[model samples]
Target: LLGVGVAQLADYTQEDLFAQALREEAAEQEQALEETEAEEEPEAVVVRRWLPGQDVRHAEFGPGWVQGSGVGRVTVRFETPWSEPGRVRTFAVDDPALEPARPLPLRRGEGMDGEGE
Candidate 1:
């Protein structure tokens, strides 16, 4: 009788372990499915209409002038008092840090220096 009881307990233990494994596998599969769905979701796209000579401000670079634009990029000529030639940097049109700015008065030798143009 004692042997039979032990055998029953062992069978129950094996069954419990199997059920737990199935639960873990199902949880993994569900998480994988959620990840796949997230990947399939379309991302929001922002369309920018930047033109040549457009005034823009950069969060870190200060005032800039839009030189040109391509599919997803914009070339900007930024004003840098530290450098006589100034600096030109390219950035994505959809950059959150770039925004329209009031036009700045052009200095005497601003864009005509031919050094940084």
Candidate 2:
């Protein structure tokens, strides 16, 4: 494995890479924002197919389940069987990145959400 900025895998050092690029990235962002113009909000999207406990995947955030959905947005709590409670994220119901996914079964050895053992 690798440590944070402790080991270098490539010709450049990790610290050196980030330290060098930080200013460049900030400059680029500043310029881009200056050139950008405000845009109109898109229409609300309706995702009636979603229901509580339904498994889903986000194009960028990976697998999760629908916690709630309505008013043009779908809220997902991205947690897996092996993970602690995951973070929640809201997305446009029609957002291209959100999609339905198959639910993973609860394997043995893992409790069904009980209190202190």
Query: What C-alpha lDDT values do all the predictions have?
Result: 0.80, 0.77
Q: How much lDDT does candidate 1 score?
A: 0.80
Q: Mind giving the per-residue lDDT tens digits that candidate 2 earns over 1-107?
A: 46556345565676689977998999999877765632344555555567888999887887799999888788999988777999999988888888887665566
Quote the positional error of residue 96 for candidate 2 in Å.
Answer: 0.8
Query: What are the per-residue Cα lDDT tens digits for candidate 1 across 1-117?
Result: 554557658988999999999999999999999999989999756598899988888888877789899989999998743446668999998998998876654554555433232
How far out, in Å, is residue 57 in model 2?
A: 0.7
Off by over 4 Å in 2: 1-48, 108-117
Residue 114 lDDT in model 1? 34
At residue 110, candidate 2 shows an lDDT of 47
Cα displacement (angstroms), candidate 1, residue 59, comes to 0.3
Residue 18, candidate 2: alpha-carbon lDDT: 92
